[model samples]
Target chain A: MMLDNTWFVEKSYFEKFAMAWKVRKKLHSEQSKFQKIEVLQTESVGKLLLLDGKTMVSEIDEFVYHEVMAHIPYMVARKCEKVLIIGGGDGGVVREFVKHKDIKQIDLVEIDERVIEVSKEFFPECTQGLDDPRVNILAEDGIAFIKSKTNEYDVIIIDSTDPEDFASGLFTSEFYKNVSNALTEEGIMMNQTENPFLDEWGVGKIYKNMRAQFPHVQSFTAPMLIYPGVFWTFGFSSKKYQGTQLNPDKIRHMQSLERSLKWYNTEWHKGAFALSNFHKKKIGL
Target chain B: MMLDNTWFVEKSYFEKFAMAWKVRKKLHSEQSKFQKIEVLQTESVGKLLLLDGKTMVSEIDEFVYHEVMAHIPYMVARKCEKVLIIGGGDGGVVREFVKHKDIKQIDLVEIDERVIEVSKEFFPECTQGLDDPRVNILAEDGIAFIKSKTNEYDVIIIDSTDPEDFASGLFTSEFYKNVSNALTEEGIMMNQTENPFLDEWGVGKIYKNMRAQFPHVQSFTAPMLIYPGVFWTFGFSSKKYQGTQLNPDKIRHMQSLERSLKWYNTEWHKGAFALSNFHKKKIGL
Candidate 1:
């Protein structure tokens, strides 16, 4: 970390609040083309990944964020043979997708190859799916890559970083249009929006941009430990899905994966859509 | 705060993680008859109430916690006219209860009178309900107070602090039996159980204790900002009523106070019970 101390502190959302993890060991530190990447072994959250001082994933919350991101939209859709992941170099999303044997082709387009490399070394569990024969790891700019595709992916997971600088294009109107065109008619796209409490404006902008292109745009929330607000949200914009619908077939599908999942479940999938009045009021949902 | 610094830090749950709030100003600080009480004007959370170095209530999250605490049981129960609140010195619970005109009487028993007095001076919004003609404030020990009453209150709200030192008794089996006996035949009680993520042992103990006493012991969670894990939970133990059950009258009751509440709603109430698989496994629910 940039700080020369035992604590790795995060000051995001205009320094409104700060959360510190006691540094047990600094696993890796480097400057990637996108941002500063650092992997730290912490006292509490175990292995912590930081991109430009913002917490991206940890050993503690990785299962929760990744499971919710990958499984929620996958279960909602009727088909999931092909998948495209953008900006998830950490491979957590890929690992979740790998759990389901039905997925035939997997494409992970991460702008920073260094993130994937680091994850393979420091966070190998998340990167195990990268070696699967059905998977394709494309180290390229996600924004440019999506514009060249059409009606391809059954499920597209935009595991983008914070909507800042280079990654900011991920939440733009032009990008949403490309994503809409990139997906099949029954496609569902889930993006890690941001903290519901801190990033209301950013989240709202993403929602607005997605709403213009997609017919169904909804949000689901889950509490994440490393996140600034803890109450984190994921934006679901699809061509034909309200999501969280109770289907007996999907219940069996969820039940089959029960022993593997630590976070996502059929009951939770339905429950995650429950947003408080203030949550809606803040993000203009 | 004990620390002579700009940040008010909380190191709870064996300091597995730490949350720090920047102090704009120290509004009040003192050692009460029980524990240390401090009220601070914070940069992010605004006015915050801290009891014995633990974050209690903040302007940003008070509505979320207090609303969930008060309204969930109130709407679930067949009757909520007579209520007893144990250890809610800040009056946040009372404030929520006061919104329901159907509630005829409320008795608030707090161990520390200073928390109430300090909140009255610094956090007037939370304490405004204390002035209601039907509300009564008693600066006495709740553990002893509940033992004296039998079948008196229709609902009991245990807004006690962490199960530490003097407040620890609030989560004990004996105390729970006393509380169950103190309530009417068809009564409900809600306690501010600690963070489900951080306090698995502590939370499980309370659940086991409550389960032994009440036939129905369910839990509901909300994202509280100042708390350790931020993913906070409350224990719902009732003689009857599988809460969050859809009732038109209760929905109307929740909707009537929609303008007054920032967090609680009928939809969110049912959703709040949606615990992640990891969350259920962690707390052994």
Candidate 2:
């Protein structure tokens, strides 16, 4: 469940550092069964969706996070048809997936239904694909939902909150095993690993455990301007494909189909894997 | 001169967004002739030097900023000697210069002397090369210092504070032309350009102005974890060579000389110039 948030100064103590945003107005606030949610109009970053006092998505820089989360796996996988997105109630991840014409189905499993409602009202551009005929919105626990399915989804995107509250089980070794079991032979899973800058978050521990569960595991980083730690990381685990080996033809073709993108591109896709030496030492790569 | 700072939450209103760090202790504070200077021990980011209420350098992640500022120019330029560092009284930029064995002379012109003394006392690692035999520390205004030199330095690093307060003259076209006159025919200049995320900073305006003063101009970005905006930019203006053209053999030989580095590498060196589409559009590149 989301934590209660203060209205004026949204301060988050990420490790020893405190990141704050000046709020113009509190658009909405309510306590749902699953978590507390708040929508805020900020002076600079436009609208913000805070789940448990944590910035889930902001209107200004959401594209950088969502694009890498969705497009990196899609462009790498030979064929991405049936997709599964967990905890992305804001619909940003789903919107990125709907850009591909070949994707037949997308199942968005969000634990809280209220997040979807608020995002639909506030972030219309981010939630554009929520009403697609091929999309299904399932209100349930993502960990339990993935446990129920086996070898069904072609691509799995774990766009969940930090693994501290309701999403704690999603970061465990057993849940990763279940995620490995739930994917098809050629499927790849993309999970939002926390920032390494905050050592208390134990991102390296989760990455090490994921490596034990999957045949191929790698991590990539991108800058998320509003996130507690601006340099954010993502965990990419694959069953049959190496995340680094990209089919340039496929990426070019995808670029042709979905022409305009703000952040992700062919060069950035390749460069994302070139982990900085500082990060290499931090993650023990 | 440095500015007085609050010892609790060091709040900075960057554009419409606010970035803050929790201060553990105020190590030192004084008013220099030019600006206000404060040395702060932050909870997360170690020893921070604030000039005119702006972050000049922080101990924890200062390497990221200084390394890129110095190494990018050194690695790209065919041969870097007789270096000029303007406004880097903290000696972080000079420390990077000392790593290159070929650099014969380093002329450090700093407007404020207290910053150097504070840095030597608090950030010894960053100020290591301040006492090197090759270094000549000039206690004078950087804008006036550069105007007096003509075709004298091989590399010019404008490691000044933001183009505000005492360093406001560094960002003007006339100052850039003076900087151009102070460099050799094959000289290259690296200046700290502010983030585009903060529209009030006018990084695009500075980039356009620099383009008029130099034959070739390009801007590259890197994540400065403790800066106001994490995705920070640096402007690279050249006279004779493209900034991206690197002598790999020279870098390899330099790596043999200076072995351990936290951020800069051959891959990252090239990737740093790979412009993000979002940034390209913002800067009208």
Winner by DockQ: 1
Question: Which residue segments of model 2 deviate by more than 4 Å?
Answer: A1-7, A10-15, A257-259, B1-7, B10-15, B254-259
Worst 10 residues of 1 chain A by lDDT: A1-10
For B176-281, candidate 2 gives per-residue lDDT tens digits of 9999999999899999887777656687788888988999888877777767767788989999877778866586775664348887776677767767677777
DockQ, per-model, please?
A: 0.55, 0.42
Each candidate structure's count of clashing pairs: 0, 9
| Model 1 whole-model lDDT (C-alpha atoms) | 0.84
TM-score of each: 0.96, 0.93
The C-alpha stretches of model 1 lying farther than 4 A from their native spots are A1-4, A246-248, B1-4, B246-248
Poorest 10 consecutive residues of model 2 chain B by lDDT? B1-10
**lDDT of all predictions, in order shown?**
0.84, 0.81
Error of 1 at B123 (Å): 1.0
lDDT by residue (B1-285, candidate 1, tens digit) is 122367787775566577888789988889977888988899888998888888999988888888888888888877789999998888999999998888899999988888889989988989999999999999889989999899988889999878879988998999999999999998898998887767644677778899899998888778888889798888888887777664467677567777667888888888878777876775566
What TM-score results for chain B in every one of the models?
0.95, 0.93
> TM-score of the candidate numbered 1?
0.96
The 10-residue segment of model 2 chain A with minimum total lDDT is A1-10
